[model samples]
Target: MPAAFPSSDPAIPTAPLTAEMRDALRAIVGEKGLIEDEHGKRPFVTDWRGLLVGGAGAVVRPGSTEEVAKVVRLCHQHGIAIVPQGGNTGLMGGATPWPAHTGIVLSLGRMNRVLDVDPVGYTMTVEAGCVLQTLQETASRHDRFLPLSLGAQGSCMIGGNLSTNAGGVQVLRYGNARNLVLGLEVVLPSGEVWDGLRALKKDNTGYDLKHLFMGAEGTLGIITKAVLKLWPAPKDVCTAWLAIRDPRAALEILSEAHSASEDNVGSCELMSRAAVDMVLRHIPGTQDPLKADTPWYLLLEWSSARARQDGAEGMSEKMEQFLADQLEAGRVLDAVIAQTGNQSRNMWRIRESVAEASRAEGPGMSFDISVAISSIPEFIARGLEAALDILPTIRPYPLGHIGDGNLHFSFMGPSGMDQQTLAQYKGAITRAVNDLVTSLGGSISAEHGIGIDKLDELSHYRSKTELDIMRTIKRALDPQNIMNPGKVLRL
Candidate 1:
């Protein structure tokens, strides 16, 4: 983690939005698409947590790719910076403009539309602003599935999801957001549209250009539309809550689950008892599935496209048998398979609500990092030792998408300590934890992209060659450095 930026302006394109330029923007998009009022532009400039307040002269919502290109073209001509935003639900300040930004916030909200759905091809073409949950439901309506899910699915847009290359619980099965996309239509910094919206699965024509923009945080270009991959809908699914012996047991159980469930392990999430309790305490309508005398728990789900018929041994039966075997092996101390839809929903609700619960609990630090699957238990052990040594009273609630080796390493500040006080120790605590991660060949910022939060950390952790290549790409694609200036890379 890195310290927050100072109030003073850093080097960004300060070209003020002139009256003529505003008129040009208004002409490109209708009045409803343009938000020049301070109150109207507030949400676009502010980060999701409301902790980072940025400044923007206006917020421009384009209804079409054409409109988006026109707005970018106008900005490019005048040397004005543009921060491309989608859903504005990003944890990183990638979509939020800098406090000194005197240009526009290009919002994709008005452009949301599902353009096409090819059931035969198993693909869907959609505008960038379409909400993730909306796309999931759309896929369901077509009897297909979109597996890129997240806690913020209801509000996070697909463009933002791709921009951050987001990873959620299902990444183990469906891969990250980038993996779910077939192609993209991006508006480059020079106002040129890159129409790479092919629905083909195998296009090795040249450099994988779509990938560059997918995780670039809109620093390289503005993603306006995309062609997304779809999978067959899961008809037989089983959800379970298990109290495991320890972190190491989690790995073993998951390792065996693939064959036991016939290779349909959709998700394997590790939850600390503290994390579960925190969720149960804050989130209403969520209940504990089981209470066992163990500090570690696992939320395992197995799903398959094959529907279960009468007299068939469904997912639950398979899972029940698997749990029995694990319990006999001394791996799972206790476990319960979800018997009803409501029961399954409750189990998932607890896992998804951890972020909300943490916010309600107050001042806390969370690091989203990933390591080799086998290295997870060791990383957890050494990482906790290092963090606790720096701040002994720090409350630990270590949890994650354990199957994918990504941990939401989190902690509550010591009792009675305010956020300001906790900030003083953040540097040391961050270093110890990240050092352990780096030593194990793990990522410091997993799932979450390097926005303002980890801008300096990326610079510090990445090799000079890696950073140099990134800076070179950023410069070549956006020479003016006006595309989301002062984000990701410091150049």
Candidate 2:
């Protein structure tokens, strides 16, 4: 069920929108672009995670970058807030409309397009609405690779990825969306377009403004399009699922595998036995990666260019041999190395289905956090201890892109624990976990971002000086606080 909001809230703008305002907005975008029906805006009104359900004055599906710019310009002119959205696959509730409904949702889903693909330059210029998988396929057509592979790649937009600076499985090697982006085309709060779409390797001309909006969560401006950097397609690929005793052993095994395969290690994800069990139990056709139920598992990948591979020099054999050594050394419990592409994909299916499988369990509080690679084990130990102490019956589902020191810490409720009760204790639990994370020199938010869901927590974790500067920038760019207002930072 969708979460409910308080009827009497200060943030919600209760003042009605005048007929003159609607006419002015409709004139900027076409009549067809304007969506007035409450039912018509229902789908776009709520967030993907179902954490935040809101109402908007109207939904405007912009067809082009210019149309988006015009809509933003009009919102700015009237001091109305604007929430730019893409596929709405965000977990942070960043794209959800405000209850104030004082704003309009700028949906760029209609602007989906691959404007240009330069195989020679190893870059692609795409609209914000282009699906991640589409971008990957388009890159593959030219014998290149767009390595930002997230679970939501099938439905999420490149715009949302860029906005979140998304880090997926490949972050262990390819880095996040911020690294993949070479240039960006954004629409400022003032309704002006800043086209910094130069796909250059090194251009230190002035301030690198792109980085500011990359993870700003749309608080500053709206990202309309972007030029993403790609890489040469890897020829030889290897995937393996190894059973480790714990996160410490998983990290140790990852270290050994990297030594044997060099930096060819593309992805090294850590998964708990419980996490894998959830997938096998809930996800259809999903089976255990290994025969025995170990305490933890590691999904390892090694990719190399075609020219780099030689006969009898496959990395899988080396990876398997290393795992064998670790098993003998008591570092690992058991392991299964994929012999074919299909088998490798099957193993990945277990890792990727974690989120969905978790949902089948029950309503819970989810956390995306990160710490130094070496500090992860301690963080987990302390975090789990803290969480269990607070919610004894809470099932701890700890998993994530461990290679990046990030973990998706979730607490599954036992039978009969209503979501409302869980939600009521959410702040206390998050504070407990975040306090531990902060003490370990870690971040409260790893990859998900500080959308509306964690805005208060962000303010809690961030220093006053840092938040002051962020507010200064938001006010400087969006004086009226109309562009994605009440999101990342609120004045």
Candidate 3:
């Protein structure tokens, strides 16, 4: 089970939703918009990983931004808390409401729509409930590309992506969700809509208010819509798999690839031998790219906007030459260049299936951390040593975007360890790894925000001054603390 909220009010009295309030909400959202039965609310209350589960007075689905505002206003007037949720695919427990707290889930799944698309301006206006894959396909249809790609793109909604400032494979090239968004339309805690959706690339006015809600995790307000930036589709692309000797060799290859390709490197992902083994074992029909096993592997890719690039060799040819040079130099043990688009996608499938494969293996502790690109090898070295010191049988499976220095460093327990035994060492292992990350000038939470999973870690690692500023902002925007209470900050 997940840890309880530190500031949970046990002595406080609980109040059930009144008939009048329910009737008013029903009037605003209609019959199909409300989910009050226990059976109906189960799907909304449980998290994606089934780690955190809760209860809700109701799960209210609003079809438009105006209806969402009305629901928020009604909840505000009644002193009831409102938990804004979209897709509910978050790894952390941010969108899941607490069982002890009585609140209604304000789901945005029904408001999915692409409002407008401007090919000339390279912008797309979309409702918050639009699926991320839908947005990507829409952009492709317009002869452009949405660079935000992730494993959960098929189901995760744009609202949740904006709420968490999600980072994915393309972040090393295009940046996170924050960089892709040009403006936002948020409904403040006071139930007033702030329409700041502008598609301009340069706006040197005053403070950029859209940033306040980008990674706020819905603590300040609800993100209803957004204007997203798009990019020209890449005409030429290449993918390669490299069997590296170690992390140092991986970093060296990354540097060489960037230099040789003139900064055309799109993504450089690292996977441990243990991680690859897990995927091959759990996922059927998956084969190792290399004939023999190595300590680590890199799934590297490059792309260019122009198809031919002034009659020079394509990216694939360049990558093939680069790999040939590295192999001859003994830096890379073995390498393979993808021959077709299907082959390229198959290579990525192995990388994307690691998380699920690891979970299927057993109970384990996972972390999303980042250090300086130069310190990655050192961080991994010391992290493994520390974890082994605690438990010699611990299996470390650290893999992620090596180009950006953010890795999902996870450790699976020994084969026969029970859940209780594994749970006992979760905190100590987390502290040990996090201590190493911080000591090396890194962040404990890299791409993932400080959701309920990392609340205590944030409070422990963040300084008093930083926490004070965050608290001040939270208080100023949400004085009543009714907007996604007990998230991102302790009450």
Could you tell me every candidate's TM-score relative to the true structure?
0.98, 0.96, 0.96
**Root-mean-square deviation of each candidate, in angstroms?**
1.7, 1.9, 1.9
Q: How many steric overlaps does candidate 3 have?
A: 0
Candidate 2 residue pairs in backbone clash: 13-100
Can you write out model 1's per-residue Cα lDDT over 1-491, one digit (the tens) per residue? 22356433447899999999999999999899899988888888888776688889899999999999999999999999999998888877888888789999999988889999998899999999999999999999999999997788889999999999999999999899899999999999999999999999999898989999988999999999999999999999999999999999999999999999999999999999999999999999999899786899999999999999999999989999999999999999999989899999999999988888987887888899999999999999998999889889999999999999999999989888888788888889998988889999999988989888788788889999999999999999999999999888888
Please report the TM-score between candidate 3 and the true structure: 0.96
lDDT of 2 by residue, 215-279 (tens): 98887888888999989998778888887788888788777777788678899888877788878
lDDT scores in order: 0.91, 0.83, 0.87
Best by TM-score: 1
lDDT by residue (197-241, candidate 3, tens digit) is 999789989999999999999999999999999999888999998
Return whichever of 2 and 3 wins on TM-score.
3
Alpha carbon lDDT of residue 253, candidate 1?
A: 98
What's the ranking of the predictions by TM-score, best on top?
A: 1, 3, 2
The TM-score obtained by model 2 is: 0.96
| Candidate 2 wrong stretches, greater than 4 Å | 4-16, 307-310
Off by over 4 Å in 1: 1-3, 6-10
TM-score computed on alpha carbons, candidate 1? 0.98
